[model samples]
Target: MLLKIGLVVIGVVILYVVVQVLLYKRDMKKTKEDLLTFVTKNKKDVSVTIIENDDVVLEWNADQKTPLASTVKLVVLFHFVKAVSSGAIKLEEKVALSDIERFYIDRTDGGAHAYWLEVNDFSEHATLLDVAKGMMQFSSNACTDYLIDRLGLEKINDQMKQAGLTEHDELMPLTPMILWSAYVSDRRRDAFKKMSGVSEEQYKSLMNEIFNIMKNDPEHKKALEEKMKKKNLLGWRIQSLLTQKLTKSTTNQYAHFMKLPG
Candidate 1:
């Protein structure tokens, strides 16, 4: 009777293993088919990854890179969270309203025009987490600009480089007038100076104010200092759709991968 019990236990174990293997294979096949079908259906290119059992499976054009658009916010969120986790910045730390933030809020009519604003009052106070959340949830351009100003554009770009995303642009907040000129003119630095009509000395002074706000956070300050000493300025690489190859389609693949079968 004991021998029979041992055999039964072994049989159950074997059955369980077989079931698990079958499930895994089925899931993988479904995923691959879904990806291929989506790619074929959509005209755009994309990358996909699956994580299971603490292992990552990537299906993508390793050499291909694309514009992140709002996806870049994920990088910002990661750095912000890391700063908080490392005790470099506090979630509850109060950030005083700057003229730029106030101007942006006012220009947009208390954020009613903008999705990022939680409160209409310019006097409304907020914590770092509030700003961070607004940035991620709303993809608030204004909030992102404010945070970038506070964090220092150079530092943010440096963090991006460290995170292994080298092909990302760090756009600093500028006036519409300046933005237009910068966009149209190849001589950006000179065009900026001409558009602002600020003397070199005055420009330096303005930069000082911006830098001062960034220095308020210890982590931001440290990152700024480190960036200044670095030889290479953080920059993004431009990729053209016509020049590159994409094995998978982005639009359909993303939808199919995320969608549940009804």
Candidate 2:
């Protein structure tokens, strides 16, 4: 009886792994055009534009405000390059690994932070250059928040304007999506209450407020961290609210950004 039960469990595990592999392979076979068609047609909540040689090639919801999500990291990368070129920040500047780890919220980033650390194989610390590489290459939010602390948020937002990205929303720290959701779970306030009253200035302020606590106030930060660690806070409602708040820009603006001088 034991042997039979163990065999059944093993078979189930094997089947699950095989299904996952097949799905991954199927997704890998999809071309850029296939992806675009699928997203634009099926995911009707998308804003996309394709520009070639200063000419508009394709567009959908071109002028509509679209959430940037992780794409906001591109702005960070652009600014980091400019800072290095202008002799503002050195590539060799070393940062303690613990400092970077502090900003990392586990499980929210789809394991990006852990994966970056694994691939880089750094022990206690890494250079600013490697950190920046992790930020762009791995899309690590931890790596980004570290840079944001080192480089002022105001300066980063100024890069968008300097690059003629008038439509781009202000850059805010990314970890708050998880932390603030946890706050809502603790019954401090609901998602709608938090989002509805927030203007651009108020939104930016709240983001900075959370980020400051993470950097400075250990006890408060610990409480928030415990909330995240102990409970699952993100629900459909908070996610919907976040989708509205997480940086937004038009499809045309995104394409325009790609055309800017690097």
Which number leads on lDDT? 2
Point out the worst 10-residue segment of candidate 2 by lDDT. 1-10
Off by over 4 Å in 2: 1-26, 31-44, 188-192, 229-231
lDDT of 2 by residue, 1-262 (tens): 3344335334533543454455368677779999778786766687779998899999888888878887787777777777776778877898999898878776777777887798779979899977876676666888988898788889999878988888888888888656775554565346557666777887777788888877777577778878756654566676778878888888888788877654
Q: How far is 187's C-alpha from truth in model 1 (Å)? A: 17
Which regions in candidate 1 have their CA more than 4 angstroms from the true location?
1-38, 41-44, 54-58, 97-113, 118-123, 166-178, 181-262
Best by TM-score: 2
Q: State every prediction's TM-score relative to the real structure.
A: 0.45, 0.82
Q: Write candidate 1's Cα lDDT for 68-108 as tens digits.
A: 44445544555565565567777677766442353242332
Clashes within 3 Å, all models in order: 0, 0
Residue pairs with backbone atoms closer than 3 Å in model 1 (clashes): none
